[model samples]
Target: MGWYGQVKTNRQLQVRCNYLNGTVNKYLRPIGGITIVADIEQMKISEYIDRAVIPLPKAEGTDYRASTITPPFGPRFNAAPPKPRGQTGFKLDGNVVSWANWKFHLAFDARVGPVISLASIYDAKKKSYRQVMYRSYISELFVLYQDPTEGWYRTMLFDSGEFGLGNFAVSLEPLNDCPSGAVFVDGYYAASDGKPVQVQDAMCIFERHSGDVMWRHSDVEREIRETRPDISIVVRMVSTVANYDYILDWEFKPSGSIKFLIGLTGVLQVKAVPYTNTDQIKEEVYGTLVAGNTIGISHDHFLTYHLDLDIDGDANSFMKTRLITKRVKDKNIPRKSYWNVEHEIAKTESDAKIQIGLNPPELLVVNPNKETKLGNNVGYRLVPGSAARPLLTIDDFPQIRAAFTNNNVWVTPYNKSEKWAGGRFVDRSRGDDTLAVWTEKNRRIENKDIVMWYTVGFHHVTCQEDFPVMPTLSVGFELKPTNFFEYSPVLKTVPPQHLSWANCTK
Candidate 1:
């Protein structure tokens, strides 16, 4: 009944009120064969079929509150670190954040959780901030389930387009969610009734020092040792999308690198089965049996990002430096093979579409007009995340609707209107207005203002550990300076005497 193509109206919804004890957790309980489809616009509802009735799932031991647990808890993994004595390194002037050598503007959007714009890093050598990225954000997010049952076939979700990621974002907990010195920021949005609603503590920003070194070198023969502290500023937010919680982070480092992290955690979407144990099953249940009569369905998640990278200026081009293997022709050569880098400039959007794999080329967005002193292009290279492509066929409805995920990386001419990857209006949307359709035009992109779209994804195959609640699973990508920097910026950071170790005798 929820199947859109089968129904006449696209605004129709199929609803089932299942029971887990007295609570309705539709995933763990199914009302068996009864479905009611209602249309929101026309205000019409079709008659439902009542073929069977199943027993309600017992919701014993479902309480997750800290006070309700009877057994002793396990040992804690982390201890509170020592508090800092000095003022924080980062400064928050309204929405503009300045930390170390990086300055960026951060804003919350109803569609996407966070919008990072005018992100430029300062160059001490030049004594001016250079353009790195103009605007960057998560364009669209698609989560597709793999169950083929009648009630679950149409379980795909366009989280960002259909339901705004910011709309579902909840308040972040202090000290627990963020560090002790984190600065909290609030957000506001218009409600359905056209009233401004404020979401307090919507985001937090803090500098992270995880006891990791930025750079280190030791020379016993020369009696020399040096190291630099690894410090980075992090802007964090958590969006609660129904049964899933997404933790989004934007990290800025002193070396002119930016990282985007997507952490997924929440209850698993489960199905009520007839049998209680896996030993009693013989056929494909479409998932793994986690608990009594509960089957956790397998699924895939894809979050496509719209990165408008301006390496040094607005005019930029995409370059793929492929590492192709070269066989040794000379028999006297000791090495059997070596890899040579073949640089290719993407002339059009079609030329930039790439599928990353075991042998992925080095993807970069560089300014053709700007170069280092050695004449190397000024660019920021992409470090791809744990990206996963859809296993479904291209003709599949979900695959077609989210056709942007066909490739792990894509480059398109900067068009202001073409922001959303799944389309403008994703409510019961088809594949018509997807990113794949727009790229068919294949506009010229060489040395022009272009956007690079990167997909951060993962395939989730459920296990017993993900049952009652799941641990946070994270995956993301990084944009690092390639030839954009003249040399490592960490070399200029003066370390304190405590960290310098100059007095130690070798």
Candidate 2:
């Protein structure tokens, strides 16, 4: 009996080891059900560590070069006018005439990916205080294509840090650095007491592949129309949050693809944390790492969802529901109609549901007392278990579902409001919010519903020196295959190739 107990305990210990390392077996029988819970608690500490290191497939060859893509515009500073209106007397007759030109400096470091490098930092001793500087990484690649014949431009899909894949677009006009369609969509009036004055410029990056435009207009139009339209677009701007100071622009392609690009002109600072693995470190040890060195925690990840009601004759609009731990059978609270309630009540209920599970310490609510900031016009909180939880686990499904069902609000062309990111009215200076009005008109004409869903994720392990000016990091969202696409759009495209020194030598 003694020997048998020893063997059983050994087996349990082994199981615990696997669980802590994220190699838990789905079908393994526990020695006893009660003991498993204890093991899980003990294992949770290391589980946090596992979440910090996202295991991407190793690059097949050393010679594989990262894409040489810069933001279509110059850096954010360049995008700003040389002088503010107070200094430049361009505002003749009390009406600003020629606005200062804005440009974006979107550059990516070839040495390393944003996520990897931003998680590492360095310190320099300046005159008085020890100054820290962070390196920048490639958050995402934004590719804009204009099918000259079609008379419309669309953005291509690319990877945005930890966020999943989707079509993302940024509306840039000849006049301003603000997202083209969004400035007016979100309704930031310069006349407002605290809003910045409107500035316009006409400088943007335009790149064209030899045959990409021709191929798109000729052979890709039908394919593009048939493609899924649930693309994602996000806008990142300087905000009150500590250490998060970059504006992200996101969009969904008409092809149902997702695209995201980074607009960096924000404050960067070093944040100190208790430990590399906080939970694992004991009471006496002071575990600390710079904020930039932390691997999985993203400044923010925003998701923009556009569902078309015209499809399937609008017989039944597809709705994704949050996974409720305790299932409720009230059909009146149909998942599809959950957003019909009063906006405030809806938001409260949504917050309640997200708070139920394992919540993160850093996640907080948008202040009700404070005046509205960029995307905070609508309320949002970071859902807990973002980093520690599994991507498609039962614990997380409901939160995802709730985001779609509860956070949704019907937007009309006339409604000029903005959330944390993308919406109909993007540009504030435009006389009429084109995208907002267009979307509203389209919704009525086509009898379609426009809704958006967002999710945030994180990873926690970080290093030192990610203080002062920290390096850049990347985060994003994805639009999965949900019968949304008419055909397998990616089927015709070839898989990505692996380049190596050996291939070149051959």
**TM-score of every prediction relative to native:** 0.94, 0.29
Write model 2 residue lDDT over 1-506, tens digit each, in one string.
Answer: 00111213211121211111221221111111111112333553221112122222111211111253334744446342232222321222221112111111222211111111111111111112110111112222211121111111111112231121111112233334442222211112233265543212211222111122211222465654322112222222322122233344332222232233433322222122233455644543212333212221222232232222122122122222243234445877755422221122123222222222432222222223222223321112222223222222322322222222122222221122422122222111121222222333333211222222223333323334333233555554333223333343333332224346443666
Q: How close is candidate 1 to the true structure, as a TM-score?
A: 0.94
C-alpha lDDT of residue 344 in model 1:
97
Off by over 4 Å in 1: 1-8, 20-33, 81-87, 496-506
lDDT of 1 by residue, 1-506 (tens): 22235435457676665665643444556555555767767888764666555444556544455666677788667655534422467888989999889999999998988999999999988889999999998999999889987666877888899889888888988777888778888878888898988889998888888678988999999999988888899999898998888999999988888999888887788776776778889988888987777778999999999999988899999999999999989999899999899999999989999999988999999999998998999999999988578899987777878899999999999999999998898877777887889999999999999999998888899998886678888888899999998888778888744543355675
Single out the weakest 10-residue window by summed lDDT for candidate 2. 114-123
**Candidate 1, which ten residues in sequence have the lowest lDDT sum?**
1-10
Cα error, candidate 2, residue 200 (Å): 5.2
